[model samples]
Target: MRVLVTGGAGFIGSNFALRARERRPEWQLTVIDAMTYAANRASLEPVLTTGEVALVEGNIADAALVDGLVADHDVVVHFAAESHNDNSLDSPWPFVESNVVGTFTLLEAIRRHGKRLHHISTDEVYGDLELDDPARFTEQTPVNPSSPYSATKASADLLVRAWIRSFGIEATVSNCSNNYGPRQHVEKFIPRQITGILQGVRPKLYGSGLNVRDWIHVDDHNDAVIAILEQGRLGETYLIGADGERNNLEIVRMLLELMGKPADWFDHVDDRPGHDLRYAIDSTKLRRETDWQPRYGDLHAGLAQTIDWYRTNESWWREAKVAAERTYERLGR
Candidate 1:
């Protein structure tokens, strides 16, 4: 099988690329990444030498480039997008360009190539979960995005759906929650906390630090995506997650315990505008329909190993941040 993955060097994308190589050694994989601050080529450096994996550095919004790649590959997994909420908060234009326009670029590829498409999304599109209510975000949940990031993602999701309904396209969407584990960019909460503890930086938690998120390890998330390709019905969206819910304060406490750091190491900062209180996904449909399962033990065990990863892979992420430094310099941030 040949798969063209946009943004495959990023968090979930890198994991998918690596896992795809393992699952199908003969598969020819092409990864097109824009090499943004959040993208670390070294995260995918191991696969670079594999010969089967080819890396093309470019933006997904480049319709000509995306169309050619989508035409060549049997499956186009559109994982590329402006992923960080904080970054999106600073600049929604890029989010609109990448998540919305870039997604449309891929949809155009499907229109021309007639290849299968799978678009990765976030559970944030369902907006804040009501703690007192019994509702959990399912594939059928109505979108009520609370942030610019989720808003753009929701917009792109709708566009992809429209292409399917109107153009007779083969497209699938996976709306997942917070992902943790190796190769995650430092700006994300999990790796941010892990890297902060390692570097003696006091990680900041917004508000009371009680915002809840369903945690899914990246490896398990990759498995779920692979299963969708192998077994899922096209033109359908799947909610991929471990159904493990955790609060920001709880995650911070775990990181503190694992690193032998103290609660004093945490700095409670003012909350970001439009921050969601919680995110929960009902993944029962995904579980019943696919042979996929979460391999990372439970929330605690997965996080324990994840913390150890940053502890051991400090050089990996330190080198990874050099790219961010350049972006900071370029933007005068």
Candidate 2:
């Protein structure tokens, strides 16, 4: 099988690429990445050196480039997007361009080529639920995006549904919860905190740090995506999660304890605009339909492993950390 993975140099995409190569050595893998600040080419170095995967640097919004790549691949796992909420708040145009227009370009290309597509999305598209709400976000949850990042993702998801129903495109969508694992950009919440502590800097929290998020390991999320690609029914949506839900405060305290610091060893920063209160996902449909399960079900264990990765792989994320911290400092975050 020839597969095209957009944003393959990014965290989750790179994990998916590595796992795909390991599971199916015979399959040819092509990665299209924009080489954004969040993307690390070093993440793909192992597979690249072995010639098991090919990396192409370009924008997925480039219709001509997307068309050619989609035509050649049997399957396209679309992971390209401007995914950071804070960055989206600062600049929404890139989110619109990459998440909305880029998705449209891929949809059109897949429609013309008749190739399979599996779109990777986020649970944030369904917006936040009240902290006291007992209900979790299912596949049936209606999209009510709160941030520009999620709004664009919601727009992309709508476009995919329209293409599937109107044009009969072969595609499936999976909205996953928060993902934390190796190769993640430092600008993201988990990595930023982890790298901050490693650098002897106090971790920063936003607001009251009471906002809840359903976290999943990146590898588990990627595994679910592959299952949906291989077994999911067309025109269907799946919510991918591992039943891991923790508020920001809980996570920060845990990180401090694990890193040998006091629970109160952190600073509270101003919250970003339109910060959602909580997000949780019920992945019952995905689990029931596919013979898939999460391996890193323990949040603390997963976090410890992630911290170890950053500790050992300093060269991979050091430069990105300096730049991301500079931006955060400028924003007083």
TM-score of each: 0.94, 0.99
Candidate 2 lDDT, tens digit per residue, 148-186? Answer: 999999999999999999999989999999999999999
- Name the regions of candidate 2 deviating beyond 4 angstroms: none
Per-model CA lDDT versus the true structure: 0.86, 0.93
| Model 1, position 268: C-alpha lDDT score | 81
Q: After superposing candidate 1, which stretches have Cα over 4 Å from the reference?
A: 319-333
Q: Best by lDDT, which number?
A: 2
Return the TM-score for candidate 1, rounded to 2 decimals.
0.94
lDDT of 1 by residue, 64-181 (tens): 9888888899998889999888778777899999999899888988898799999999999989876666678899899999878999999999999999999999889899888999
Candidate 2, residue 47: lDDT: 95
- What is candidate 1's CA lDDT for residue 124? 94
For every candidate structure, what is the RMSD over all alpha carbons to the true structure, in angstroms?
Answer: 2.5, 0.7
